[model samples]
Target: MTISVERAFGLLRIVCEADRPPRFSDIVGISGLPKSTVNRLLATLGDQGLVRFDVEDKCYRPGFGLLSLAAGTWAGLDIRRAAADEMAAMLAELGETVHLAVLDGDEIIYLDKLESAQSIRLFSAVGKRGPVYCTGIGKAILAELDEAQREAIIAGLAPRPYTAHTLTSPETLRAELEAIHRRGCAYDMEEHEEGIRCVAVAIRNFRGEPIAGLSVTSTASRLAGTRMTDEIRPRILAAGRRISAALGHLPTPC
Candidate 1:
């Protein structure tokens, strides 16, 4: 039974990896299987909807059943679990705080956090609620929403100033969100806490909907100038892509 299953999967892999749909002879040639066995496996695969016989092209191709299976797997992925390695890597590299958060209406709730090694760190905990307009992860998630949804969310908020650098004007916040979306990242330059700053990116799901955010947090002085641009931004953005990819979000073509 195990050998039978392995042979079936081997045939499936040949079909799936082919640049073009392959004929029965092609499968038999590539798999080195006898004609009778290849025919039987192909017929069984077609019955299961794992492969389909194309009449016009006279070749075998992958079936929609594969998509259904893939969708189910992607949907079941836990965001925190998907992001765990990337978060730990960021903490190790920068010795700064790393955060994972999800949008909760007009705010963001921390899903997980890795505290900085330094004694002076941002005061936050898992499940803590934060303002959407001022924090890095919050703005990253907000920037991924559609214009109508973004506008509605902003209109509903009071937009109070959280610190000296926080932008209270809706017009300015909207402009910043637009910039964040365009650049594929967001920032909190002492906008939330007086000395804290961060860079963040949105994590999307299989449907291309932004479901969560990942960020790197540190003191403003530590994240300034060259370090922010060369090291931090690239790392956080890469982490976002890794997590989003794990959730089955395809990258938009450049």
Candidate 2:
């Protein structure tokens, strides 16, 4: 296992340094590995899309897998770093948990979570993924998607009622999305977890499409009064706007 890993990285480095895609014979010569061993390693890499084999030219180069992996890592860091101060401010002002998440297919994956000081706070973690139909962040992002795209995603989801407040009906969820669009925000009224509620706004991209969502979660009783609208709504929207601007949201010319 160790030998294979070392050889694979060895081949990867060799390919990376080449002026152009290196031929099979060139790799074998440079790596000092047997031709058969080099071929096996290259084949394994090709299957994983870690290396692109140019059959026509009979050469090897780095593949989309590497690019995709690197891009995702950098993008996650960019969002987390950019939103650090804003999330901290929210945490301080409300003394509640704040979350940063991005849409991953039909789910919203929490990338960064800042827990509140209180003992009874929202239950979640950095790697946690949840249903788009029930969570505030997920619904916020889902609201901004195009009709066809939204419908496609909804067709795949089988909404389960996590609580009585959970929007289970497809028709009902569609209506909720419409309201969210008009209001430019979404709410979790104890939908995913009883006693917890959230208010969130979409973080749009340069093309004015939702790329992520930001939210604050607190106990339902605390958010029930004027706090939800007078306080949380504007604060979250302001942060969402800042994040959207950072993401290069240039409004389209009419």
Candidate 3:
């Protein structure tokens, strides 16, 4: 491996991990990079617009260039169209909301949503987004990532609590993702919204990476206990499998 390249990326990661703009001293301490090297790389990064230095706080934050790059990547995905038929079927059969989402940095962006026929139903806007450590679709995508990739994303997440049940600690969220991977599923136990609960499964690409996830959402009163296991979980998995197959993905043999 290229040592200098790795160190430069490590410094960048340190800045990204900070909840707010990071000072030079903080980057040096967290990255364990020599002060001189860190200073040089930061200057180069600033010139390239990968980071911007704030004069008032004497700290660095992610720059607009990074956001533009990320936007380009998210724009190219065809997740909404790919899962359209399956989502409609699930919504009709279960009479519950069906959601399709894909990871975007440390969050999951809702590509599409099929609302339930019931009067009491969850309604997530098509372009809505949620924390990767909290929502069912978010955790489903996170669970399918490689350990190194997932850890890198987790390092930058703030883990703020949206509800009483949110996993606000890194260790707990890490454990949760690991369990979801083993079980081939994830659950949102009112982690994002107080009245909502969901069951989700990852949607893999041809390469077997979870490019997206699908969820069946309902009121906590409807899905909070055995009803989820007895009803929602199986249907959600079946829908996810069909979508994955359409995307040219086949699960590997255990």
Candidate 4:
């Protein structure tokens, strides 16, 4: 049976929005499409290697084919290439691990990292995924979301505590997100991982939607004693603003 390309794309959206790989029932619940139709779409997408189902986990996630697509897209307007010098400068100035990330569903996918020269540094690899509820880059991007979208994403989350300081309660996490909006920046207070702290600010496009985030991370010992909020926040915000400007975002009246 021939399927419409648009409908196939619609099914793809459901998997893309999910945090963990979603179960068949979960996809059915969210997409509101008929079960048979959804199953057919999933099968087609899986056959094309655009999605993969884990037999043991009984869940579906994006597949390597999507990475190929991303690589092609990235090759054209590579944010890492465009922003590397600025990130390097920031890393030099701050002597902390600098990261560039973009939102992928309810997660932040780290695209690039600039390690600090400091002897004591927090190690993070490029291509790492962090929860949007706890990481600084995640919060920075989340702050750009409207209430409804934010609530919907949270509704779909299965909060797994990564550390003692992680925000496990939805209510508490929402409140912290609110504070991040108020402050025009976000912080990772050992939420995603113990002993690590990070600060971040959002980069927006011409439409004012957050397209990326820039962050600086270190051990709690370094961030706790330093005046990071006062000193580093402005620098991070400046970098984000510059990137947004490069993406043609003009400041609108708040």
Candidate 5:
């Protein structure tokens, strides 16, 4: 079953990445699979609307089902371009690494990052996934979510100690999240990576739901003492508000 599934995806890749729509022969040749297996898998893919047989061109092309999937994915997240300027400005002001990430299931996925000019900076990259219960970006986002959703996420978490400072107990993490909610920001005090610290705030959509998180990260020495609260926290919180507003979120009247 696994081999069959792999072969199916193998054929699907050949069709999807071709310069033009690929014919049956093209897929078989590119995939190096038997003709019978290719034909059977193509039929299965066509049935699922992942690929289609183009009558006029007599070639395989990506199907409307894939477009439907893509649309659903793209509809929820479109904040990168809107966030670029704010990230750049934050990086310039702090001379620290800036990251934009979104919650994906039980993890946080980095979407964009602005490199710090300083010789010392946190090690991270766009597309990297990190534990939701530990990182500043993840905790900030969790703090902003509705209680039911937040509880559900917390209940499902399997946390471990990444560093001595890491909060491994669910009860302790719950308390930390509550504090983040009150402060409107979250902090990672060398919890995930030793010698690294960061401040993060939630980026919301028009519905006022946290769709992403924005964070400024630097070495512990750089962010030590009152710097995180007096400097980094306020700036990142302001940037989050601007980016959320750009995405059409309106803050509730206080």
Candidate 6:
């Protein structure tokens, strides 16, 4: 079938902007397209496994095919392979879940995860995607975006509360991202999921754009009262720096 690339991209934008799965009617409403046209497009997307319709909820969400493509892309990235050992060593030393993620549109997609030896660990799948405004790794990568780009991306998001701690307001999230840029690190203070805390730093390539991030996630109870900056932050930053170096980034003293 000959699909219009423009129409396909338009549908993709609608899906990516949604906070949760969107109802068929909602997509039609948002796109201002005819019901028959929308249905045809959705049917095509479904056949490709890029989107799945939930009969019970009557909503459409991203499907496994998108994840499979993402995984294949990640597998081909030399940076991910080069940093795998370092990520594993860091996870082993800290006894916390370590993640390597890259930005996909307005979200962060986990490319790799190193499970900790500890009995208690945050359960995160390798191909899982999370909102940039709520995750440490996402925020770390977002810190590299310029103000205009950041605003454009934030404007496109339909923020929904994932947890009580999730930042739902764009104003507040923008302020937090600004701080992350200045500090060179970002924190997830139970923003995406309750009981989870994380610290992340950006991995930049030779062009100085953040292409990925490295993060450590653990329960809030474990991180509480501990000097994270004095101890954990350095380690996380080191890992990020190492990945950046492997990606051809040369550090200039700040």
Lowest-sum lDDT 10-residue window in model 2: 70-79
**Estimated TM-score for each candidate:** 0.76, 0.69, 0.67, 0.67, 0.70, 0.67
User: What do the candidate models score in CA lDDT, each in turn?
Assistant: 0.91, 0.90, 0.85, 0.85, 0.91, 0.84
Q: After superposition, how far is residue 37 of candidate 6 from its true place, in Å?
A: 68
- Model 5, 64-113: lDDT tens digits are 89988867865765799889999999888889999999999889999998
RMSD for each model, in Å, please?
4.3, 9.9, 14.4, 14.2, 13.9, 16.3
RMSD of 2: 9.9
Between the candidate structures 2 and 4, which one is better when assessed by lDDT? 2
lDDT of 4 by residue, 89-121 (tens): 888888888999999998989999988877654
Q: For model 6, what is the C-alpha lDDT against the true structure?
A: 0.84
List ranges where model 4 is wrong by over 4 Å.
Answer: 1-77, 119-123
Residue-level lDDT tens digits of model 1 in 1-254: 69889999999999999998999999999999999999999888888889999999899999778989887886689999999999999999989899999999999999999998787657568999999999999899999998898999999989877899998999999999999998899989999999998999999997899999999988988888878778899889998998999988898798
Off by over 4 Å in 5: 1-77
Error of 1 at 75 (Å): 3.9
* 10 residues in a row with least lDDT, candidate 4: 116-125
**Candidate 5 TM-score, true structure as reference:** 0.70
**Residue 68 of candidate 5: its Cα lDDT?**
88
Can you give the lDDT of residue 155 in candidate 6? 92
Displacement of the residue 192 alpha carbon in candidate 5, Å: 0.3
Better of 1 and 6 by lDDT: 1
